[model samples]
Target: MRLKETEPEEIKLNMTAMIDIVFQLLVFFIMTFKVVAMEGDFNIRMPLASQNQEESMDEDFPTIIYVQLAAGTNGNINSIIVDDDTTFSDTDMYSKLTQLVESKIAAEGNPEDSKETEVEFDIARELKYSYTVKAIEAVSGKVVDGQIKKLIQKIKFKDSTSF
Candidate 1:
């Protein structure tokens, strides 16, 4: 007996939906991607290692402001000293340092130019990290109304062993 043969079914894959989804994903990622500014983009000026003898002897040397932090027995900040004369406790460091920096800026007669002043931080090795950050913020100054006011743009970190 002869049996009738049936035709084989054809199987096909639909790639249109997959291609559309892939394109959508690519568009979404492209739209959401962010370009970040690099650390060198701020145009920060670093101190030069050498200078002319005449320029070094000039009386208009950059005003150096010293911030010394003394650590207590427990590794906390015991006292804060500014220019070796003014002193502030841990709680009053912010206000006092801000006032001192503001006064220094005012004394310069040119608040717009922050290059004339230099800040040096003499931090102790045992001091807490938070204290060091607070000290830096104090010397950096803050915005007062709408304008951006800076005390000193040149900041130097001395050797911790010097403290």
Candidate 2:
């Protein structure tokens, strides 16, 4: 009697195609990654006027406060003098900022009638993140309800410069 014929083994799957598809998907993801930057900057386009109304007080304002930020040697912001002060530090900066805002609010009396307060940081071109962040933090703390904003009035350093 003839022996029963043995059935052939099923063909195995070829993982090469699967691997290629996976590689293609990986490459697609790498190429499609989004580039988002956190640094904020102000737009520099001044609107043109019809030249009818006369401009007044463009150069000097009496009620403006100047805050200067400088990178200290100790690296923890040792000196952050507001307007003019001999000695100051990061810890005292917030208190001073709060006091200033409080004084301004007190002087204004009515919250609605009070003029919008602006804080300026005359920062150096080579200023570091440590100094800038502290200034921002101080201003934020001083302004209740997060109204205090650090508007980028001037960027001293060029775009090429990295801080």
Candidate 3:
């Protein structure tokens, strides 16, 4: 007896479900993505190390203002010190700092001469990043009524052992 010829069945994968799942995942990720605002947008001019230190020091050397941030045990700023002579609490930081910068500029004979001054933030390693930003903003100056007054344009950061 002769056996009947048999034909093989073709198996095919249904990719529609897989493609749909992939598209769903892409949409989920895209929808869940977050956009964060940038921190510290102030334009501060930093000193370059390539220039001759002696030459700059001779005549046009920028006046240095030291700002020290003392951190408390809770990681917040406990005290703010300017030039190591005056200390201010956090509540009065902005006003006092602005006053100090304004007074310094006034003493220079011309408010425009304040650009020749440099603010050095000698921050403690243990301090929080917020404190540093606060210190920078303090000396960055503010707008009064309608005029935009800039206190110091140049800024520097230094390491300090104490808080």
lDDT per residue, candidate 1, 1-163, as tens digits? 9999989889899999999999999999999999998652212444444443355577477788888888998789888888999998857877789888888888878877667787888888989887887777777767789865666676777742211
Off by over 4 Å in 1: 1-59, 159-163
- Determine which window of 10 residues in candidate 1 has minimal summed lDDT: 40-49
How well does candidate 3 score on lDDT at residue 59? 73
lDDT of 2: 0.52
Which lDDT values do the candidates have, in the order given? 0.76, 0.52, 0.78
| Regions of model 3 farther than 4 Å from truth | 1-40, 45-59, 159-163
**1-163 in candidate 2: lDDT tens per residue?**
9999999999999999999999999999999998998886433323233321123235333243456666556444545556565235646666676566556546866544233444556666566676676565555344448675332232222222211
Give, for candidate 3, the lowest lDDT window spanning 10 residues. 46-55
Highest lDDT among the candidates is held by which one? 3
| Model 3: pairs clashing at backbone N, Cα or C within 3 Å | 70-163
Q: Count clashes in each candidate, considering only residues at least 3 apart in sequence or on different chains.
A: 0, 0, 1
Ranking by TM-score: 3, 1, 2
Pick the winner on TM-score between candidates 1 and 2. 1
Winning model by TM-score:
3
